[model samples]
Each structure stands twice: as structure tokens, then as C-alpha cells.
Target: MIRKRKHVISIGISATFLGIFFFFITLNNVHTDTYDIARFSTAGETIRSPITIENEQETERKTRETVQSVPDRFNISTEITQERVNYIEEVFDAIATLESEELGEKENEDDKETNGDRLVPLSNQEKVNRLKQILSEPITESLENETLIQLIISPQDDREAGRKLFVENLETVLNNGVRTENIQSAISEINQSIKYATLNEELKQPLTELSKFAVVENSFFDVEQTQEARKEAASNVDPVVIRAGEVIVQEGQTITNEIYEELNLVGLLDGQRNFFPAIGLALLIFLICSMIGYELYLLMKENKLEKGKLISIIGISILIISVLKLVSLFLTSENQIFYIVPIATGAFLLKLLINERVAIIFTALFSIISGIIFNGEIAGSLNIEAVIYFFFSQLAALTFLTNVKDRTSILKSGFGVMVVNIITILLFVFLTFEKYDLIDLLIQTSFGIISAFLSVVLTIGLLPFFETVLGVLTDIKLLQLSNPNQPLLKKLLTETPGTYHHSVMVANISETACEAVGANGLLARVGAYYHDIGKTVRPQYFIENQMSNRNPHDFIDPKESAKIIISHPYDGAKQLKKYKLPKEIIDIAEQHHGTSLLKFFYYKEKEKEKEREEVGQIDESIFRYPGPKPQTKEAAIICICDSVEAAVRSLNEPTEDKIEEIVAAIINDRMTDGQLDESPLTLKELKIINRTICGTLKGIFHSRIQYPLKEAK
Candidate 1:
């Protein structure tokens, strides 16, 4: 519970530090400045738009103009043509009915009669009046009485011909649509067609007059259609936008009302405070911090998050953000200065000091921040080019720095980053299709080269600081310590050369086994080199150093021998601590010989006790090495390999079966005795370690075939 609380507190502190750093660094970029000048005033300096916005008033005006310019729509309804034709048909049909009725009346008055006796055959005026009553009011009112009377008095055949001609002419004129403006012309056309017909003057006059009644307006204005047309026109009008960084007013130029409104629209006017950009920036920071916190929590769960690593990550992130902020202060839309920021320095440092995952996470986070920082003074906009450039540059660094063996690898990785940066810049330029002069291209390319150089310089310079100040054990530090000239290694080599040889053998076997189990092979090898440093304190007491076949242990009491043997692990740990080596190295030195019973010494003392007939008086604890046990895979594997190496060396003629037997027996002893219980090694990994160790041992101790020798030929 206490450890859990500490992890939570550490995560909180890391998140808070990064959050505050990110917010303050990017705060000014998202902030907008208000101007004090008014409309129509002389400009002090050139003002650029802080935000992108639509000019609604200008857009509305364009829409209004577009809508007004759309002509009023009229509907040429087809039903009107049919209705007018029906009117003409009705008049002809009425005339036929009247003639039939009049004839019937005449026939009723006399079956057969002379023209004078035809009941004074109805007069044209009386006929007209009867026709008016018989026909509908509109038809009657439209045609004059004289036209009707002429139709009444004409011969039946002549009247039928006139009616047919009139109807034909009227239908033709009316079918062609007549609006309010063109109705008179349509009526005149009909009258001309009728007047030129082969009919009498009386009939012609009546038919000419009949054309007026037939032709009427057929087309009318449609309110809904006109409104719909205007709506469509309005929809097609595009909104006018004032883009961010657009010049609102030129320097030394009068600030017109238009420019003033534009400045106001972009929130550069007085009394304008857009907290939205700040809020958005805060949310972005929150998201980045949340991701970082989750990643740290995962590392903590995996037991990879040490205090030094956590501090290093926080320190690197703060340093990178601060540098970005400082560079962004002088940034302009015209200048591409962000390319020289040396962002890959953070990636190198993180990868070397910590792990790749943390480095990658921070790289991506920094890339996102780069988009905002290098936004060309445009708030609420992301510079996609900057994002892509940083992401690719850092990714190239990570890819090229596959092996962090030494500082030279970092320099080579910096070259790779430089190449990628140049290519990325070239890609942006080519994709834009803009013509860049040779000098301009060279200048941009130089920024990429400079950026890479800066990254290498900073990484090389700061690497030692982090290693020394934070006690972060990187691969480079391990490699440095692996050098044979180191003080502790030299002491171990000269004073205990036999022990040193044995240690070298153990180091080889331990490195192989640890690597097979997916542990730190370098660290395992380094630890093995110094694991038996305590033997240097009394080199002759150890069997390997007693070269003359004389036993130093034979003169010492068995109990006293156990005390000397048990002090070695602790003494080596003390020496390592005094030298201020990494804690991992100290752990290996301290925990290689865990609390396993020294059976040979214990049995020897037991035999003495048995001679006195007091076997139960021998305390088993006194013959055991005091230990906290191996707490890691590497340390645990070293413990098993250390015993296996010494035990294998004891055989007079070591065979493969003998080597395997001793290795398996020692591993079984460690497992059954619970010495490996505290270490994180699983049964499956231990099996892998067993196979790897046997393979390496076979290679180290393989036999050569003996040949029969004749007389010295």
C-alpha cells in the first residue's frame, strides 16, 4: 500500500510538472493581443489576423445581390390553353343549338311553308338576344351583339364555315401562350388570320371580332417558383472568409472601417478576450499529460519506473518544451526556423537513459506540441508540415539508433535524422509546387543539417550529466565500466588472477543464459566480472587460486573457513558501493551467493561433531551465506551459473553427461532450497536458461580426439 501510494504520488508530480510546463510554454502562442486604435485611424504597424473567420456581413450582401439578380419565374400553365379552346368550342356549339331550335320552331308553325310564312323568320336582333340568353354569361359578354347577329343571318353552310374558320384561328392563337403583356398581339394575329379567310364581309367582321373573345392570357407569375429560384441562388453564394495571418491593415496606411471590422472579426480589436484558445490549449495539455500518466503507471506496474528514470523523463520533457517556447518566440510565418530545434536530442537521451517506449511516447507528444508551436503565429491552427517533419525526424533517430552501444552510435543516428529532415523539407517544398530559388533551398536544407548536429552535440554533452547526477545506468555507462582498466576490475585481475579467470567463465555463461531468458545480457556479464571480487581480499584461501595443489583451507578450522567464505559477497558489495557503481551492479555483487548452505564446510564440521559424538550441536545457520536473495532474472541466473562453473571445474575429465548432471543438480538445489523464490524467473524461463547454459558450457569444454603417435616422425 505504501509503495502504491508512492507510485501514485510520483505519477501526479510528473504529470503536474509536464502540464505546467506545456501550458506556460504554449500560452503566449494561443493568446491574442487587443488593439486600442479605432476605425479610420492611421495605422501604427502592420496588423495580421489572429484567427480565421467568415465575414458574415459581406457574405450576406453577396447573397442578397445574388438572390435579387435571379429573374422572377413565370409558369406557362398548359391548362389555360385548353380552357380558352373550350370557350371557343362553347360559342360554336351554342350557335348550332340556337339554329336547330329556331328551325324546329319554324317547322312547328307550319309543316311546309314559303320563306315569308316562316313565322316572320326571326330577325337578326331578336336572334342575337335569344343567343345571348342561351349562351353562358362570359361568352355572351365577350362577343359583341353585331357579331352574333351576323352569325344568325348567314346561310347555314356559310355560318358553319365561318364558325369552323373562327374556331381554328382562335385555337391556334390561344395555344401559343399569351401573357398580360402579349395578349393584344395574340388577338391581332387571330383577327388577321380570320380576315384573310374566304368568307363574306359580314361573316369576316363577326369572325374578326370573335378572335378577341378566344385569346386571353395563358401564362402567369408563380410566387413559389420565383422564391425557390431566389433561394437556390442564395445557397450558391460562397461565404467570404478572412484567413488567419492575413494582413488586416498595412503599416503607415489608414485603418479603414473595413479593415477595422476585419480586425475586430479576428479578435484583434479592443474588449475582445477569447479564452477559447487558452481552454483548447489546456485540454490538449491535459490529454498529453493523461497519456504520459498512463504510460508511467504501466511502467510502474512492470517495475521499470525507478526514481532516476522518472526524473530523467520529466527533466528531458521540460527542457525540450522550454527550448521550443524560446524558439517560437522569434518564429514567423515566413521563416522556417523550427527545423533547427534539435528535437531528436530528447529522443536520444530518453532512449539511452530509459527505454524506447518512453522515448517514442515523448517524441509523439512533442511532435503534437510542435504543430501548435510552429503554427506560423496562427492560433487555433495546426501546422501539419511541422508535425510531419518532427515525427519523421525523431522516428528516423529511433530507427537508426538500434544499438546504443556507445556515443559513436548516437552520432551516426544523428546523421540519419539529418538526412530524413532534409528529405522531409524537400517533400514539403515539392508538394507545394512553389518555385524556390537555389539559395532558398540550400538555406532550408542547412537548417536540417544544423538541427542534426545540434542534437548530437546536446545528447553527447548531457549524457554524462544525467548518468552522474541522476545515477541512471545506461548501456554506455555499463560499457565504460566493462573496460578492463577500471580500478575495481584491475584489483580483481592482479590479486586474484585464477578467480578472475573463473569469473570470466562465469560472465560468459551468465550473459548467454540471461540473454536467452530475455534479461540484460551486458549487465549480467558486467555483474559476473565483479561477483567474486571479495575473493581478492584473500585470494589464496579460495581453491582456484591455490595453484600448487596445497590446500589453504586444510590449515584453518572448518567453522572459521565458513565465516571467511560467507564474507566475500558482502565485502564485494561494500567495495562496489564505495566505488559508487550503479545499484544493479551492487545488487549482483551482493546477491550472487544467496542464503544457501555451504554443504562441504557444514559436513566437515558435522564430521568433527560426530567424532566427538555431538553431531546435533553443529548449527546449520552458521554454515550458510547471509543473503537478501537474487531479486532479478540476471542476478538469479548468475547465482546458479557461479556454482555450476566452480562445480564443473572440479571434475578430472569432464564429459557432456557430467557437465549436464552438475548443472541440473545445482539448479535443482537452488529451486528446492527456495533460493530463486524471490527472483522473477518462471519455470519456463529457467528451462531456457538451462538449455542455454548447457550449450555454452559444451562449446567451452568440448573434447579433442586423441591420435596414436609413432616414433617422432
Candidate 2:
């Protein structure tokens, strides 16, 4: 139920954050301004489009023009050309038939009279009528009476020659597509061909007249093809779009109908409902928050999620977004004000206070959000330049801020960010091809330089507040605590020098061992330094601090000595809590002993009880330190190192072999004693830890060269 409550609260917090983000993003997008101006009225101020939209009216007009510009498509009919040629052939064939009919009548009449008297030939006028009857109606109607008569009276060879010339020329003229406008010109060309042909002059007139009948408009209008051509032209016409930031009207200029329509098209005019930008902003905020929430879920599953880190993420995100929005107010096309925003500050803080992965994820989110927020010219339009600038700036910080332990590292990284920012700015400037003055160039580069420094400054300032207020122990905090001059550390050094020295040694061993097993080595080291702080409560009771070669436990009762030994862990925990150190540090102080029995006191008491025949009365729990056990890999590692360091220090002659043997034995004893049961350390990690500790101890206790009389010299 408690876990469920945490999830619910976390979800609620995430929802609240998303709501706030949506509100901020929508501030610029959602407009409530009323434009009282009307069409063809003078404008009070220049109006730019708030949103990008297609001018459907203008687009349709352009499409109409484009479609009209396409000429009508027509198909030339080959069948018509062949039919015209056949008509000319029929006229000549009819003339030849008249001659043949006249010759056949002459032969029959000669047979009847027994004399070759000339038979009555068909007259030219009679032949003309007969020819008209034999030919098609279109051919007969097109030719004149005198033209047909002339062709009938002409020699048959002249008629044949005229027919061949007219048919060939007619076919050529008809084959070349003739529309209604060009049909007369085509007929004239065919007539000229007939006039120039090697035909009898009298027949040429008839053939020229025949050419008129042969050439009628062979090419006709094709409605389907014309419609298809227009459709293709319309499809090619691009939509007319009035882009965001485009000037709809200039100040002191008349607002014409076109300009007013454009204003209405882009949703700048009053009564135009535009909810798309707000909807888009809401969706963007939702997506960003969902990703962050998922990251938090992963952290929670890994037991790495703390209230402090969660608050840090929320706080840093809010700070970055608020900064962007505030700066966006100053941002303009003439001035790239977004360049001066300390966007990398969020990346630095997240990396230092929380973790790098979260920093990277939020950096990209910040960059994207910055792009939209810094779009000063218009709402719902992206400034790709801003996105590229912020991303590289933060990415540079993430890349170079490598040593979180060093306080100056953030500043050092700022230099890298500065270089990258300047380069990114220069890239924009050069790529734009627009002329920029020297002052403008300097000012833009200065923004990049200012951004880097500002990020460093803000990150440095915010870190202590988060570390102190949230009770979070970061690497920098650990580094500071490791200083010997720190209050608790100094106290340990001045009051219990022997134990202090032992702590330093244990810290070294624990750090190495923890790192070997992929655990937080710095955390283990810092924890180790404070783990023996409990021993400082009664320093003389601990063997290392009994420097006078005397033991305080010698005079005390075995039960009292055991109680004093066990109380130290809790005593150190109390002092640490009093100082309000982070929970992890206090945990190490409290759990390093891990409920292990004080064997010396326990055995001593057992001996006394055995002598008195009261061994059964002695309880093992009385001699054990009260512990919750080491609950983390670092805490578990500190526990083993703490015992191993103390055990090795007590050895009369510590050697490489002896150190290795004792390290392995101590780790084995801790495992068997179940001191590490609660920790997440695996058997494989334990083996690795064992080897690391042995190597570290062996290095520390390696054989030293003995000097003879040279020492006195």
C-alpha cells in the first residue's frame, strides 16, 4: 500500500508538472486578441500571421489560371483522311465510266447500222449530272456543276493525273491536323498543289474545286483529353500558403481585401477558432512528461529513486523552461536572444545532482522545448536554429563535465561549451548567407560566451542548495567530506588518530574493492571514512586507538565491554544524524558492524560462564551490535573492508601472504555470519571483492627494505 501510494503521488506530481509545462508553452500559442479591423480598412499596426495556413481562395484561383493556361487537346482522325482520298478517286472513276459507257454505245450502234456512224456521246452537262449521281452526296454537294462538267469533257489521262495529284495532296493536307480555324488554309494548300501539278489547265480548275471537298476539318475537339490535360495542370499547382511571420499588412498601409483575407486565413482575425497550437503544445508536454515518468519508474525499480532526486528533476526542468519562456519574450528575428539562455545549466545540475542519463534525456527535451519557445516571430512554428544551438551547447557540457568530484570541473566544462556554442552560432551565420555587421557578429558570439559562463555560474550556485536542502550526497559532497579538515573527520583525527588512520586505510581498500565489482567506489570510500566514526565514541575501547599499549576492556566486565562495543555503531549513527548528514552515510556508520558478534568479549564471557558452569545463561545476541545489515553494495563492501582493515592492523607481522589469507578469511566469515544477507551483492561480486581487497592489502603491507648503518649517516 505504501509503494502504491508513492507511485500515485509520483504520478500526481508528474501530472502537475505536465500541466504547468502545458500552461507555459500555451502562453505564446493560445491567442485571445480581437482584431476589430475590417476588409479595405486602414490598419493601425502591421499584422503578421500567427499561424501557417494554406490560402484556399488564392490556391483555387491559381489552380484555375493554371488549368486555363493548358490548351485544349484534339485527336486527328486518320479515317477522315482516307475517306477524303476515296471521294476524289470516285469522281475520277465516274468520269472514266462515262467515257466507257459512250464507247460501248458506239460499238452497239455500229453493229446495228452495219456502218461506223459516230454514236451520240454523253454531253459534258449530262455526264456532270450522271457523275454527281454516282459519287457520294458529300462529294457531289461540295463540287460545282461546271467543275464536274469540265472534268467529264477532259481527256481520261488528264482526269487520271488530276485525280492522283489531288488525292495525294489532299491526304497530306488532311493528315496534318486541321482544326476548325485551319481547315480553309489546308484546302488552299491542296488547291495550290493541284494548280501546279502536270495536269491539263482546264482540269486543274475542276481538281482545285475538288480539293475543297477533300479537306474538311479532320482534327476535332476531344473533351476527355482536354479535361485530362487540365486536370494534370491543376494537380501540378502548389498550394498557396501564408506562412507564419509573413507580413499580412504594413503599418500605416491600407488593409486591402486580399490582406484581410490572408489575416483571416492564418487565424489572426477575431472570431477565428484556432485550437491546434494549444493541442499540439499539450501533446508535446505530455510526451516529455511521460518519458521522464518512465525514467523515474526505472530509477524506482533500481531503488535509486529518492525524493531529493525527483525534486531535483522537477525543479531543474521548471527552472530551464521558465528561463526559456522569459528569454523568449526578448527573442526576435533581429536579435537571437535565445542564444544567451543558460540552457546547459540544467544539464550540469542534473548530471551533478542526479545522474548523467537523466541529464542527457532532459537536455534533448529542453532543446526541443527551447526551439518552440524561442520561435519569436510566430507561435506554433519551430526555430530549428535554436534547437541546434541549445542541443550542442548542452551536449558539450555533458561531454566535458567529466569530474563531478572537482568543483572547478563545471567551470572547466564551460569553456568547451563556450567554444561549441560560438562555433554553432558561426555556423548559423555563415550558412544563412545574409550579411551581418561586425557588431552583430560580436554580439551573437558574446551570447554564446555568456551562455556558457551563465550555465557554469547557475550550476555552481544551485548545487549546494540541492545538496544541503535535499540531504543528497553527490560525488562533490563526498569529495568535500573526504577532506581531513571536515568537522567529523577532524574530530576523529584529533581525538582518535589511530582509528582515523585505520579509517583512511579501510577507505582505500573499500573503494578499490567496490569499484572492482562495478559498485560506487567513491560512495564506498566516503562511507568507509565514516564507518569507523562509531569507534571514535569510545576510542580507547577499540584496539587501534589503545596506543598506550593498555586496554580499557581489561578492567571492564565482559558484558559491559560487549555493550560498549555494540553501542558504538548506534552512537556514530546518532552523531551523524545530529549533523544531518545524508542517509547513506549514516547507514554505513550504523550497518558496517552488521550485527556481528564481538567475538573477543563474547568468548571471554563464555569462558567465565564455563568456569562457573553457567555457559547456558550467556546469550549471543547480547554481544552483537544492533544492525539492519548492509543494505547496499557499497555498505556491504565497507563492512567487509572495515573488519579486514582492523584485523590486519592487529597482526604482529603483516605480510603479502598473511594479508591475502586474512582478507579472504574475513570476507568468508562475514558471508557465513550472514552479515551480507540484506545487501544486493552477488556471489560473483563477492569473489571479485575478495580478490580486490587481497590485492589492495598486499600492496599496502608489501615488504619494505631494511637500512643498516646508512640510516644513521
Off by over 4 Å in 1: 34-48, 73-225, 248-273, 614-619, 709-713
Report clash pairs, candidate 2: none
Candidate 1 C-alpha lDDT tens digits along 152-269? 7777788778877777776676665678999889888878877687877777877777777777888789999999999999999989999888888889999888888788778887
* Model 2 spans with C-alpha error above 4 angstroms: 1-8, 11-19, 22-27, 30-48, 69-232, 247-276, 377-380, 577-580, 653-661, 704-713
Q: Candidate 2, residue 658: CA error in Å?
A: 4.6
> Model 1's lDDT to the true fold?
0.87
Q: What TM-score does prediction 1 earn?
A: 0.76
**Residue 596 lDDT in candidate 2:** 90
- lDDT (Cα, tens digit) per residue for candidate 2, span 611-653: 8886376788999887888888888999998889888988889
Whole-model lDDT per candidate: 0.87, 0.84
* Strongest candidate by lDDT: 1
